[model samples]
Target: MNNRWLLPEYIEDVLPEAAWQVEDVRAKLLSLFKSYGYELVIPPHVEYIESLTGIEGDDLNLKTFKLVDQITGRQLGLRADMTPQVARIDAHLLNRMDVTRLCYAGHVVHTLPAGHFSTREPLQVGAEIYGSKNLTADIEIIELMSSALKVAGISEMNVDIGHVGIFRTICELAKASPQIVDQLFTALQTKDLPSIAELTINWEESLKVAVLALPSLFGEAESVLATARLKLPTVPAIQDALETIERVCVHLATIGVRCSVELGELRTGFYHNGLVFTAFAKGWSNPVARGGRYDNIGQQFGRARAATGFSIDLRDILRGLSTPSGKMSILAPDSQEPELRELIAKLRESGEIVRVDISGGSSDELAWDRKIVKSVNGWEVVSK
Candidate 1:
């Protein structure tokens, strides 16, 4: 008897059914993006560490898998997020002075969280709209996100939307010292309210109560308005930010994009400015997709471009829902190899996703077919 455990914490071994579902979601997203005039851009998973920096903030620096590139003797890191890579493409490679819409489906790696549902590696599908700061761009991204989820057959998924500026506005209004702001940020990250309250204990009663209520201010649009009604009276900056969020929400509702408004939802990178959101599905604790506007990052690379994008964690979504079975048959050529090649090519062009059989005889072909059929369970195979 041999017992071997061969797997790491964050890495995953997805079986056939779930893997097919993941692929299905990726295909649907890609198709939708293409229809919207967004061209595909596939960035390398490995990049110079400096390239990924200044976009994700400290989170990227901490979770990135780093290695010394023997070829160039420079440090390279596995991309933890696709946004920065996309930014680099827009600013340095394409040199498209105008706004460019790019879409991608790829894998990203990060350090695994302890005892959490987070995967160290995940397949992501997303799109970026560059060189546009208009609110229409924001609405369009959210609309596409919802449509993509609908195409994936994922219903009841809620979008929790907020702006980074709103959170920062509150921090400043509280007159929070750098240390206190850092502590409040930590509490915000963990959704810890008690720590926030303790920090504002010495403040005036009204200010202290508003500061403590930050974590609980997350819910529907009306809930955000209700919370803002209280805190905004004392802090003019926060009040103005809240009004902006309310306007964005009203616009979203008018467009029939239904999302629960969350005032304090603020887990984002340094690049975000106008709006940020996370899409949640049933049976998944963490958000399956996250996106927002990041205007400053492109400027850091000297482009001064305004851009926004979101990424879907394919692994998390596959874990939450099942997709239809994909049955593929490898048709072997009986005597005419070219004819069979033509048939395979036609099937591929039609998007049927077929493969050509390469076994020597019928028996060998049948044996190979049986293995796949049995493993996939629902897959059917026929050989001529």
Candidate 2:
């Protein structure tokens, strides 16, 4: 009897078109990152647990896969998020006098996801901006993020912007107890207004209602603002955050792009101390991408720098892409070896994936296709 548990709940197997879509989206995203002056960086998958400590907050404590290095006897963990690793690079390796823009494309490991179908090992494509505290820098990150999503084949995506400080500021005014603060954060995440109202009775009637109402105050940009204006107190910090969100939408609109603004959104990681935003695809329940301003993470790594950036889960991208097929061509071997190499190099250089036929001349095309050596209907044969 063989006892083998082959499949895990949080990991996935992407096949064919979906797989192709993942790679294609990655390439396009990397290209966009480069065009924006973001230098690509690939961090090692395994690192000393100390390296990733205090990075992703509670998520890190739960999702990391741990192992012991036999030679060094140090505890190692698979990275749960790339942003912290990027932060380490900015603070240590790339400690330059000038601002550094770093981008990463890689897999992040996590345990237990909100959705049953979520991947345990998620592929991410994202960028991090260092050495800038200017609001314009935040806006540029948002702008570039929107453009990158469009390039990834998300035609009608919506970006919802929020400020972490707004909710925290409001909580302070409410004088929320620890229980109430946790409950408020939970209610905001779940969008449960009644529960929030239940916990808010100790505050002023109008304030309680306003606090409770925030959970439901989300919609189209204008509608969200209209609803929020009626529900929220006239606090300067909250108002400023709202104004920042408004400006972001206005900036996107002038570029002929539309984004929804929401003030109640919360980030899984508290890294974002300022503005936070999420990108959603039509018909998808959860966000395909999320990022925000973390002015403090750099400080934690020995540099008191302000930073903001965003990342997309490539697995979600594969789920959202409406592309019909993920195909690549491989030219069959030529009688002249140099010709075959030339064709392969030329195709790859032009950004088209191709494989040179290395097997003997009479290799079966059907068998090769079955092995995924070339995408179905994406192979060609040439003879010299």
Candidate 3:
């Protein structure tokens, strides 16, 4: 016989203990977002393929699971990321000109795991700020992300910050072709200096030196920024990128959040045009949170709004935290008596977990610490 009950590789259920933790943490995060004036949005699990993957580039497209809708025949895709959907809502649905704050929590399905030990279905929790291009927006996003992790019981985390525009500006100056840029981007991700040199062999000396220096510009925020300023050309765009990183890092430092700068950290993908960051907890091997500025993302939705945000996978955060203790429940006998029913209802109303024994079976399998028994005092709870 076949083991038909097995789940797919990289896909598994959130059992009771984990599910409770996920819900508990999700509630706290949503509450936190709300406190920050971020209105919550619940986007659909699926949408037109264009709306989901149009601006995020080939990486997101590869992760999305696509299928033709039965009714309209238009292609539909399981959302791999909700940022694009939130952008659409802000652009088309809300259409507000002022700075809009939106937060979302939902399951995003990916065709493949993002990493070796990752899940295909991740409960993504995120907050976005639109219509603000100020560096303050980036600062607020980073601060909010730091606060979010702390609220989730992850107090010690390193925020690895980078600016994609730094590399993009250098590439533009070198007049690198898209293919060459793609090759260099892959190499830089791995800090492969040899491959970077090979790719930029034909480039001018100055441009090649700047490109090669990117991989080495990784360390403490202040020193890295200082080194970057000294090594990189004083082009206006590159300087602006460096300044942004400095300003954000300084603010994070003031708030007691530790951060590092990685000039070659462009893992956020093509759409993220500016400041990008990843939050790594002490014990976790993978980033627990990621977000950055993707101003052009709204352009695809017919409105170009300056946007910044970050998302945390609840499962990832849960992995680092100890499992939440199971809630104690009270066992009650299944009965039709009005008084018994009233007592159970009253107990439930008072924040008690009441599990009625409808099957009249053994209580050994039940996770109940107390029981309701008919005694001298109408109906009373007693230790089981």
Candidate 4:
């Protein structure tokens, strides 16, 4: 019977109660975006492999699941992320010169699960702003993302900001070979200070000290920036990088949003040209949401718009959350009575869930809250 009982690992069904949670959050979040003038778009699930693997999509390459097309006999890949797809929409599809605010909510399948998020499939809900390089645009996207988590019942959320520009610029000034750059990138990612020291042994004194200090340049915004300004070389690129991070922090504070700076975070070095960040709630070790500025992501599509955005896995935010309560329902007898049918229709129109009981005895399929009963007056609702 082809192992009907077995299913793939990391993929499972959402029962009724859990489905209700996902649906409720989806409705609330999409409505929130619409209120903010961010139009929602749903790109195709699969596309020509090249369309998704543009310069911006390099980070997603290893995560994408590719397959052969049956009709065209060409290669196709399931989208691992939706940012590039939205970039294409802004660049090629809309072709608007003015700013474009786009938001999306959909399932993105990955070849492997990411840290602590064991599911290979994630429900990514995000918002992006195009054609605006001002820090305001970045703040707006971050605000929207922070608000999303709050609305999802997360509390005490702090957004930790970073900049790929900080490290990228430092590396450029060090003039390290590509091979050395690769090694330093890995060493920094893992915070292997010994390896980082070893990699920077040949660089000039100031440059070497700055490269080694990069890993420790993380904490509350002012404190980290203070340390960076004193300890790191005062090169133009490093100065500009620090300035941008401070500007983002200032903007976030004006909006009453809590944020900190972490200079080592280069989540989008492959695509991001400026700032990057991750969002965390009080209790979680891993970020509940993450995003950054990847300006010129649409360059591949010929527009080259400046852009920034953020996204969160809807499923992960509610991972520890219990399934929502079942639908509140009223039980009624199955009958040909016109009056009873009319009553049911009225209840349904009033947004009440009325289920007709087909079996004479009780059925355990539905968790009905009330039952309709005949009375001297009109029908009465009795507690179940």
**Top lDDT: which candidate number?**
3
Question: Model 2 over residues 273-315: C-alpha lDDT tens digits?
Answer: 7888888877667787789988868666787677889887777
What's the number of clashes in each of the models?
0, 1, 0, 0
Instruction: For each candidate in turn, give its C-alpha RMSD to the true structure in angstroms.
Output: 5.6, 5.3, 1.4, 2.0
lDDT of 4 by residue, 298-317 (tens): 98888899999989888877
lDDT of each: 0.73, 0.75, 0.91, 0.84
Q: Which ten residues in a row have the lowest lDDT in candidate 2?
A: 366-375
lDDT of 1 at 65: 85
Candidate 3: pairs in clash? none
- Each candidate structure's TM-score, on Cα atoms with residue i matched to residue i, is 0.81, 0.82, 0.96, 0.93
What TM-score does candidate 1 reach? 0.81
Q: Output the lDDT of residue 350, model 4.
A: 95
Give the per-residue lDDT digits (tens) of candidate 1, residues 11-52.
Answer: 878877678678777888899999988999999999999887
Ranking by TM-score: 3, 4, 2, 1
Clashing pairs in 1: none
- The C-alpha local distance difference test score for the whole of candidate 3 amounts to 0.91
Clashing pairs in 2: 10-120
C-alpha positional error of residue 37 in candidate 1 after TM-score superposition, expressed in Å: 2.1
